[model samples]
Target: MNTSLSLLADLLKTAQKEGADRADILFIQTQSVSYQIRNGKMEETESSEQNEIGLRVFLGKKSAIISTTELKPDEFPRLASQALAMAKVLPEDKFSDLLEASSPQRLSKNLELFDPTLPTNDNILAYITEMEEQALAQKGITNSNGSSAAYGKSHIILLTSNGFKGEYQHSSFSAGISVVAGQGPTMQRDYATHTTTFYRDLDTAKSLGLQAAQRALARLNPKKPRTANLPIVFDPRIAGSLLGHFASAIKGNAIARGTSFLKQALGRTIFPKEVTIMDDPTCKKGLRSRPFDAEGVKAAPLTLVEEGTLQHWLLDIRSANQLNLPTNGRASRSPSSPPTPTHTNLYFKNGSHSRTDLMADIKEGIYITEMMGSAINGLTGDYSRGASGFMIRNGQLAEPVAEFTIAGNLNDMFANIGLANDLEFRYGVNSPTLRVHSMTVAGA
Candidate 1:
């Protein structure tokens, strides 16, 4: 066994000897470096390295967790003893238990999650500098907020007394730029970013900077349209928020508590038949891809929504047990907290229409490129948010618009959703450009 795995196994043994009925250990190591440039100068450079261990002990129905950065062999006994004592005084939770043992499935293919070509400080600084320079050179771009480049890698090792042991490592690289256009009261700001598991897959710094500058320039001199019920389109950049809200409304915990708006919508058609949402944890080189969840359960792709019908809830072991269902392997955890249900790489399937095709028939509509604030009621699915973008007129984008509020109930919005074919996996939770038939626009 590896040193970290051996250490965790020893910790689990110590916990068992300390009177715990069950136990698990998690070890993590991370390293990261980042560089930022502003106004043609390198403004900051930062780096971090961390190694930590977390221990969880269960005494029948009671459990407690403890964590430490110190990996010294002598510390295991004290950590285990402390956890056992804590568990003794805690209230029993019927749902808290380790997963049953099963034969582990080996990955069918390489995930390509790690990139060994670590960029030096100078390389990161150069990328940021070039991005900032490119953004500042754009016409009408008055200043730069900043350009940044970062790289990070994380290693996770999980061990449990129930014969589950797994370890994995992943890497990430990203670059971004934010710039301001126009000047004074008419000034507008926008940003662009690109991230990838492989260093070579990241977009060029120059391209990112140019995109940011162009976006900011396009937003100069904004106007607010008259209040009315109008079609509202979401840019791919912010369209994922709609999917996020839907994901939250179907979480197992919320459903179990009867607090989710989608709690009673299971097996019902909640959207157009063309709409399908998915969560996959095994995609090669995916940002959040993993072979197994934090609980050592094998991870697989889940069709959360199939043909517009709610199919599954995001669940962890505890929530699944409470709901009397099997886990979907969505459990996530941190050193200081127990496992919780979370998404890996959630996204919607592409639709038949292109962005232009979706907008072609809308004589008047708001194409939302940016959103601010959140006014959502999870229980009712009532949604409202400040929005800014360009107005779509006669099948073309025309005139910048801002300072407007879009309001609708999610149930209606989902049913009315019109998706475009421009889906890209730039973000972990991604969607193509989407349009809603009608929404109340609160504006001038």
Candidate 2:
């Protein structure tokens, strides 16, 4: 048995002796190294490792959680007893408890999450420096905001008093560069970044640097459009934000508290007939892939929206109990907090039309590539955000625009969505280029 598993089992026995009805524990160990370069020089380098353990104990209807980096075997008794004592005085929460159903009989197949090739500081520094140099080599590229390369690995172990033991490991490699174009007040900036489970899968430094430079050069001397209700095209880079809002609104806790605009919208048609969305925790080599969730529950694939209808809410054990629904195994947790509902690898499906075809009919619109601050009303679905991008004039991209606000109710926006066929899984929440019809654009 793993040393951590033995320690956790001992802690559970200690908790039982302290009058706890149930308990669960988590162990996480991580190692990471990163390098940052700017102006053709090494600006910073860091390497770190962490070992942490969290314990949660239940006393009837109450529970308490605590964490510590002290992994000594003698410390288990005090940590377990302290958690039980804390649980004794807490207010009763009828809905807070472990899953009554048995653990999944079988775990999912190996997801190939780990990459054995570790990164050396020397290699990372070289990689980042080269990335920055390439960006600064561009004609109009004035300066570099920064360039970075990083690699990390983490291992997790979970155990429960009622017989659940599981563990997994994952690795990550990432690189990015941001550059400025032009000079003085008219200068603009852009960045290109990519992350992957395997080091070989990362985008080349030359490609990323050039891409960032070109994007920044495209944004010089942006003009603000006159305020009007016009079609809005969301670039694939930023379109996933819409899916994020949907995830937040359908969190089981939000629905249970009646704080979500979509609280009462379940099973209804929330999007156009062609729209479909999915959440897959078991996707191979996915950024967020995991065989089981924080609470030792196996997470199967979930179709959140199918053919326009809202299919399910993201749910954990407590919220599912409150709403009288079966837990869908979406629980996520940290060392010192209780579990919460969250999605893993969420994305909308692609549509039949090309991006050009999707925007061909729009004479004037905004093709937003980036967004700023947010002002979303959960109960009302009112949405507004600062934005910057290019103008769509005569069915083609025109000069860049900035200092504008896009405003619309999410309910209306969802219904008006028109998707393009260019979808890629570059992010945990991915989407194709999409257009929303007739939204208010607040600008000069």
Residues 186-227 of candidate 1: C-alpha lDDT, one tens digit per residue? 899999999999999999988998999999999999999779
Q: Judge candidate 2 at residue 62 and give its lDDT.
A: 96
Task: After superposing candidate 2 on the true structure, give the runs of residues whose Cα lies further than 4 Å from its correct spot.
Answer: 101-104
Candidate 1 TM-score versus the reference: 0.98
Q: Residues 1-444, candidate 2, lDDT per residue (tens digit)?
A: 377778778887787777779988888889998888889777888889998888889988999998988677788778888898788889999998887647444877689889989877777777887788888888999999999998999998888877888888989999999999999999999999999988888888888988998899999999998899999999999999999999999999999999999999999999999999999999888899998999888869999999999999999999999999988999999877899999999999999999999999999999999999999999999999999999999889999999999999999999999999999988889999999998999999
Q: How close is candidate 2 to the true structure, as a TM-score?
A: 0.98
Worst 10 residues of 2 by lDDT: 100-109
